[model samples]
Target: MKYLNALRNQWIAARGWMFCTLLLAGLLIYVMQSYVQLSANMPTRLVPYDLHLMEGPVEVGASAGYTDEDYLTEIAVADTQLHSTWTPNNVESQYARFQNRMTPALYAKVGNDLQGRLPDLENSERSQALFVEHTEALEDTVRVTGRLRAWIGSEQVEDRPIAYRVRYAFSDGVPYVAGFSVEEE
Candidate 1:
């Protein structure tokens, strides 16, 4: 109590210093509160106008049934669109293209692959056989699902492209004809 009284008396006497110290404490508190608020809001950051910047080009025709022509066509379309769009640099455009075009193409390819493979499996005694014995590789037998996003050029708007993505899968375990479809957002 005595030491507090002495400190109080000293502070009262040093009005200038006391005012400065109070101001500094208030400033420090304000700064800390602001920092806390900013951190709290970090997760709520706005989605980028262009999502394509973050996601790479969408892959198409990964299925075993996809012929070289189909693969080449898809790739050519994507490449041409990307090259022509002014906003190819924009993230959103890239993402939109992947979602709209590339994803659907991939799904189709997976379905085709499964359809082709399942018929052959019915004849073979080994259901687990990895790949076609003569032509295709063993790794081609496995069905896979994945999601990806890519940017594509807009024919109308050179500066802005579209962003898109697709989530799909193929599974033989489902009993019905194996297939792939886009997942609902």
Candidate 2:
């Protein structure tokens, strides 16, 4: 009877340990499942709290040896603005700035034309301002539509609608002005 009692006590102890182990495992699995569900229900998008700006050289072209659309639009608008708006005092300097933006061939033609008109522009004290109304970026080209107002010696001479199509080409990941034309509208 004493031996039987000892064996019975050992069996109860083993069963108690097994039950405790199984209960702990079940609890862990339930917690894991709850955590997965919570994660699944969370939002994926993040909203930024603050904007940080860093100063550096701007990357103008794409990595795949192509012109970036945003960069092209920005350049086209800026170049057109520079070309369209100028006073007699600044026309030479503004036109000179195009040497950097334009292809050598195009710049040569433009330089000659502007040079020929330089005397007249300066003598008349001409000034022009462009008000940009619409800007569109297309494949390989940008179309900028605006109103051009011209003044000669403080007298308003003309106010007219204007549209410019600026063509761009990439060489070694650098964009250059390939063609520029005034679109008749």
Best by TM-score: 2
Candidate 2: residue pairs that collide: none
Please write out the lDDT profile of model 2 over residues 1-185, one tens digit for every residue.
Answer: 99999999999999999999999999999999999999999866422333245253334443553445766787888889878899988887777776578888887778688678777877767799988898898767999999999998879999999999999877755678888999755
Q: How close is every model to the real structure, measured as TM-score?
A: 0.21, 0.62
> What C-alpha lDDT values do all the predictions have?
0.38, 0.81
**Which candidate's lDDT is highest?**
2
Tell how far residue 57 is off in model 1, in angstroms: 8.2
TM-score of 1: 0.21
The alpha-carbon lDDT assigned to residue 112 of candidate 2 equals 80
Model 1, 57-174: lDDT tens per residue?
A: 3322344353243333333334333322223134245434433433344536553553454444444332110111111112212222222232232222112223222122333211
